[model samples]
Target: MEVTDVNNVKIYNLSCGKTFPDWLPDRKKRQLLKKEPSLKRRIELIQDFEMPQLCNTINLSSNGEYIFACGVYKPTMRCYDLNNLSMKFERCFDSEIIKCKPLSDDYTKLVFMFCDRYVEFHSQSGRYYRLRIPKFGRDLDYHPPNCDLFFVGDTSDIIRLNLEKGQFLNPYQGSSTSFNCCKVNPFHHLLVCGSTDGQVEAWDPRIRERVGSLDCALSALTVDPQGIPAIRSIAFKDGVNLAVGTETGLVLLYDLRANKPYYTKDHMYGLPIKSVVFHQEWVISMDSKVVKIWDRETGKPFTSVQSQYDLNDLCLVPETGMFFLACENQKIQSFFIPSMGPAPKWCSFLDSIVEELEEDQDDAIYDDYKFVTTKDLEEIGLNHLIGTNLLRSYMHGFFIDHRLYNKAKATSNPFAYERYKKKKIAEAMEAASGDRVKLQPKLPKVNQELAKKLYDLELSGDGSRKAKQTVALLKDERFKSLFENEDFQIEQDD
Candidate 1:
C-alpha cells in the first residue's frame, strides 16, 4: 500500500515503512528498495563521562588531543584523551581548583590555579612545584609566542610570571575593580582582561600600559535595572573582533576599529552567560539550561539545544568540527556541528526571482547625453568665425562685469575692502616670485610680574586656596592677560 502526504503525493510504502519520491527512475527505485535507512542523524553525542565531583572548568590542548578539567567541589585535576574518551591521569590538589591550562601544545606540562592563593605546576616527567601568590588569581593566560611566560589576574592587578625559573616578573595594574576573566590575543600578543566593573582593558605587555579599553555597560542599548553587569566570559574572532558575555546574559561583539559593539544579542534572559566559544562562522553561547549557536556574520540564532546540566565551559576542536561542553553535573558532553550546506528553499526561491529581475534590467535600453562637437554647433545655423568671436567677447564681458560688481560691493564694507586689498597684495606677491605669503609671529604678551606673583602663591603652604583666589582674579579683564596669550591690552587701549 502507498501512503500520500499532505500535498497528495505518494511518498511512503506503508507495508515496509520505506519512503521514496514518486519521480524516482526504475533503476533508482530498485536501489532504494535494497538500500538501508537514508535518514541518518547529523549530530551524535559520542561519550558522556561523569566525574566524581562537579567540574567547573575545562581546557583543551592546542593539538586537540587531550582535555584538562578541574572541579571546585573536589580538589582534583584530570586529563582525558579525546580520541579514546578515557581518563589519562588524575591528581589530587591541596585546595579547590579554580582553573587549569596546558603549558604546551603537546599537553606535557600543566598549570593549575587553586583558591588557596597557590599555583601548582605539574609535568609529565613527574616534576612538580608550588608557588604562593599574594592574592587569589582569577584567570590565567599564556603568551602565544613565548609559552614560558604566563599572566595571572587577581583583584587589583595582573602579574606576569616566568614558568622556566618559577619566579614572578613585572606586575601590570589593571582596573580598580576585581578581574573575572582574561585572554591573550594570539595575533597581537596583547593581554586582555575583563573586570567585575563591566570593563575590558587591553594592555601591551612590552610597555605595560593599557592600549585600549571598552566598557560593556556603556555599549548596551538597554541597561539592566539591577546594576552594571559584569563581564563573565570573552572570546576572540579573527584576532580583531571580540565577543564578550555579560552577567545579564547579553553577548556583545566588538570590532577593534569602533568603541561600541557591532552586534549585540540577548542570548539569555536573566541567567549569567557561563561560556562563549567562536568556531568557524558560528558563535556558541551557553547558559544554565540552553546552548545557543548563532551565525557570526548575521547575528541570527541558528539553533538552540536544551541541556539537562548547567554548562560551565566550552571548547571547540579545530581539526574536527566537534565541540565539548563541560557541565556542572560532572559530565563532559560532546557534539558534532555540521557545516552550513545548501541554501534554504525560501532563500533560493527569492534569489532566483532577484536573478530574473537582474537579467530583465540588463536587457533594458537607456539614452545618455553626449558632448556636442564644434561641427554640430555650426550646423545649428551660425557662421564659425562670427560664433567664435561672439563667444570670446561674451566671456570677456561676463568676467569684467563680475569683477566690477565685486569691487563696488567691497567698497561699501570697510572689512570687505581691507580683505580685498590684502588678497590683491597676496596675489601680486605670488605672481612676482611664485612664493607663498608668510605669516608674522606675534610677540609674547605675558606680564612677568603677575606670573611671578601667581607662582609664589602656588608655592605657598595654602596653595589650594591661593590657586582658587588666583582663578577668580584672572576672570577680571585687567588680569586676564596673566592667563591668556592674547594681546588684550592693545584692544583695551583702542
Candidate 2:
C-alpha cells in the first residue's frame, strides 16, 4: 500500500490490491490464479460515427478539440466536435482530399492537400487562401518551429512554403521521385518524408541535402512473387527513434544516429501498412486487415483487433489509448485499448467505466448459438439435429446446442454439398411434382424454341412439323417421353 501525507490526512483507497485472500474460502490457503491465461485486453468501442464516404484520412486539431475526416466520394470533408462527440458540419470540395493538417492551434485554421496540384486553406467560415504546387500533393506537414508548410508529392523534392510572407521557400531534394508521407519530429524538429521508392529520408532545413537515416526500410521483403515495396507511413517515438511502415507490410525502427535500422517487424498480412505510431511503451500498427499493438522492447504482439471493414488510416487520439480509425464503410471507428493507457484527463470517468467492465461478466450475444446457412444443413447433415437439442433454428441459420462446429464438420461428409447439388439438378431435370408449391418451383433451363415447338406438336398447331422435322423428333426417345407425358401438356382447365 502507498500512502501520501498531504496534510496529516489518513485516507485509504480500497481499490488498491491487498495481500489477503478475498475471493477464497476462509482458513484455507489457495493460490489466487489469474482468471485468464492471457492478457485480457478489454478494448471497448467508444465511437462509430458516420462519414460522407470512404474516410481516406483522419486528423485531429492541435488542441484535440475537433476531428477532420475526408475522402474521395465527392471529395468531401466532415468535421466533428470532440467535446460533444457530434458532427459540427461537412464541407464539399472539387478535388480529392488526400491529406489534412491544422495550420493553427484550433480547427478553425486548416489546410488541405488535394490529389491534384492544389493546396487549400479553410476556416470555420469558408476558404481563406489557396496555393498551387508544381506536382500533385500526396502528403502534407506543418513545422511550428520554422512556421513553414512542408509538401511532398510527385516531384523529387520537398516544397517548403512560408506562411508569414506568403512565399515559397527553398526545397529539399530527396532520393526518390514521389513521396507518400511527410512529418516533422517534435523532439529534433527534423522534417522526415517517406518516399514511394521505399526510402525514409530526413532533412534539416539548414542543409541543402538530407541529413538523417537515408536507408531503405523495405530491404527485408524476400517473398518471390511480391513486387517492390514503398514507404507509406512514418512515426517518431522520439528524435532518435523512427518507425517506418511500408506498403509491403513491413515496419522498420531506425535510430537517427546510425544508418542501419534498430529492428524490423512484418505485419504478416501482405497488405499495405496504413498507419504506424508509438504510444506509451507499445508500437501500434494498422493494416487493411487488423490493428496490432506490440511491445516496443520485445517486439511481440500485445493484442490485436480485426476491423469490421478494410482500413484506410488510423490516428492516435492525443495522449490517450483511444484511437479513431477511418475505413471504407462510410463510418469512422474508435476503440479504447485499456492496455495502451488510461483515459485522458478530459474523460477521466472512463477509468471507472473500464474498472466496472473488468469486474462485470459479459454474456455472448448469441449464447450457445451457431449460425448455419441453408447449405450448411445439407452439407453438415443437420436435418435430424434441427428439431432435437443438437440444433436450434434462429433467423436464417441453425444454432448447435449439443454438438460443436468442429465435431459436426468432422462427422459430416465433406462432399455432401456436391452430392446434394447433383441430386437437385437431377430432380430439376425430371419434371417437378404435381404437389410442388403453387408458386412454381424452379426447373432447369432449356431452349425456349424447342419447348415451344414441342408444345405446338402436342396441340397439332401450325408450327407442327409435317415431314422431316416430325420424323426426326419422333425417332428420338427423349421426345417420346416429352410428347406422352401428361405433365408436359398445356391444359387450360380441368
The candidate that achieves the highest TM-score relative to the unseen native structure? 2
Q: Taking the candidates one at a time, how many backbone clashes does each contain?
A: 0, 0
Q: Lowest-scoring 10 consecutive residues by lDDT in candidate 1?
A: 7-16
Which is the leading candidate under lDDT?
2
All models: lDDT? 0.65, 0.72
Give the Cα-based TM-score of candidate 1 against the true structure: 0.58
- What lDDT tens digits, residue by residue, belong to model 2 across residues 11-73? 111112223333557434233324432213322222335565688898888888788888868
Residue range 24-48, candidate 1, lDDT tens digits: 7889867765665442211112233
Off by over 4 Å in 2: 1-48, 221-228, 362-494
In angstroms, what RMSD does candidate 2 have relative to the true structure?
22.4
Model 2 lDDT on a 0 to 1 scale: 0.72
